[model samples]
Target: MKKIALCAAALIAAIPAASFAQEADSTEATAPDGTRAFGIEPYIGIMGGYDSYDKRSEFGSPRGGKMNGALIQGVAGVNVPIGPAFVGVEGNVAKGFGDIDWEYGVKGRVGARAGESGMIYASGGYEWVNGKRAYSDQKDWIYGVGVEVGPKDIGLGGVTGNSGVRLRFEVDTYDFDSIRPMAGAVVHF
Candidate 1:
């Protein structure tokens, strides 16, 4: 939707001004070697996965009244590290195959650092989904938990150290209406 895109753009544009207004402090994110992490890290990635709906009737069945399909998505977000923990906001737009048409959402994440550049976090947000014209569109609240392991933690530190790339895995519920699982890679800057 135009509104969603505009809102996400506004949020991303405001990050720098907001972050710079804050004074540097000891609470800032730090690496294992005691160096400060990027004050505000912005990232983007592409993910692919599946979405299974709980109510087949609402989504219209392409296969024996069963509503489910594969999805590919684009993701973007920013993280602010605070000591060993971090907080961030992310936005995603997805295209679906089979019974689904499209999906989009925005979420907020909060969690602690895991092994060098890795992170362990939980997220919640609002999502809008569109299915085959067999039914009306739907929107709901979504919640999930995920992890991101940097190349260094995965044993690529020697080659990709500070490259800002990480592997991400996540699972979320569409307001208890559906189960969604996704995985991808993200690069921060």
Candidate 2:
């Protein structure tokens, strides 16, 4: 009878410890940082760079020129994981150069986390630009490659859940004759 009582006591003591171990394992797996590994992140960003339009002659005079300007883009997108790489789609609106244009695209990137602070990624996307000009309205496809570096915890406040920055550089082209480099920064959510 004493042996049975002691066995019961040992089992009762082990129960709480076993429960604690399970709780601790779950906590480590479902932590906030771990949850950020993949998701949709809507962000607002600004880009400042040179823009060059194809030289077209209107009424026998050169009309397109290269200029420096600032652009504001709003992005809504999701990041998906494939093994060690990530793929995403972004729908964006860019307003600049006295006009507003709509761009929707898909981006593919290979990236890894940097400690507990941020991630570094190299990405490329295909974008379709549609808008009007002084002469007429047009649509074109632009392909580019770029790099982005930003915080791991991207949320309402910022990179650290308060305020953080994202940077990108891309060279986009509509045709062989029209290629331009663009760079910009975004205050991530």
Candidate 3:
């Protein structure tokens, strides 16, 4: 409960900062093609990260430790572009390391885009943690912030031949205690 409260507080505190970012990017919030980002972006990608577990009150058994590995997850979401701001809801499923065999969640995100090249956003969601231990599966909330930068945004336009392709990096906390950091490639179209 403490972790959830902290995450909620942090997200609430970030609202003003997100507003400032949107205001700054309002003058130029288009993609490279001079159009706002839109549509249902369904993407499949692989994510590798370190998963840390809570030491205290993490269940009565202290057998399973932290896991460091990768998980392949599929994400599908729709983005509503409102001038320089964007809002979206996404759902994902992943299989990974440690006592965590698999997990799934749905998240909502809001952010500001700097042209079509990149975006910075904050997200929170409800997740089900599928642990390897019997009776270890649990439900909880997760929150995090992330940034996406595309090839077009970084002066790699002609070479990458990529539209809506972006690099994703984020650090998310689950069960209000476990932290998982992930990075992957995705396309918005």
Index of the highest-lDDT prediction: 1
User: Could you give candidate 2's per-residue lDDT for residues 122-164 as a string of tens digits?
Assistant: 4444555444444333444444445555554333334345354
Clashes of 2: 5
lDDT string for model 1 (1-189, tens) is: 445644654564456346534635555645453546557878999999999987554565555565678999999999887655667999999999987899999998877678878888877789998887564588877877899988878789899867788999999888766788999999988
lDDT of 3 by residue, 1-189 (tens): 757666775675466456546656455554444565444445555556666666553533555544334566767777666545567788888886655788789988877676557778878888886777543777788887888888877888887765678888988887557777888887766
Model 2 regions more than 4 Å off: 1-44, 56-70, 98-134, 151-165, 186-189
Q: Cα miss at 163, model 2 (Å)?
A: 6.1
Better of 1 and 3 by TM-score: 1
Candidate 3: residue 95 Cα off by (Å)? 0.4
TM-score of predicted model 2? 0.50
lDDT of 1: 0.78
- Model 2 scores a C-alpha lDDT of 0.46
Q: What is the C-alpha lDDT of each candidate?
A: 0.78, 0.46, 0.69
RMSD to truth, every model: 7.0, 17.9, 4.3
Residue 73 in model 2: lDDT: 56
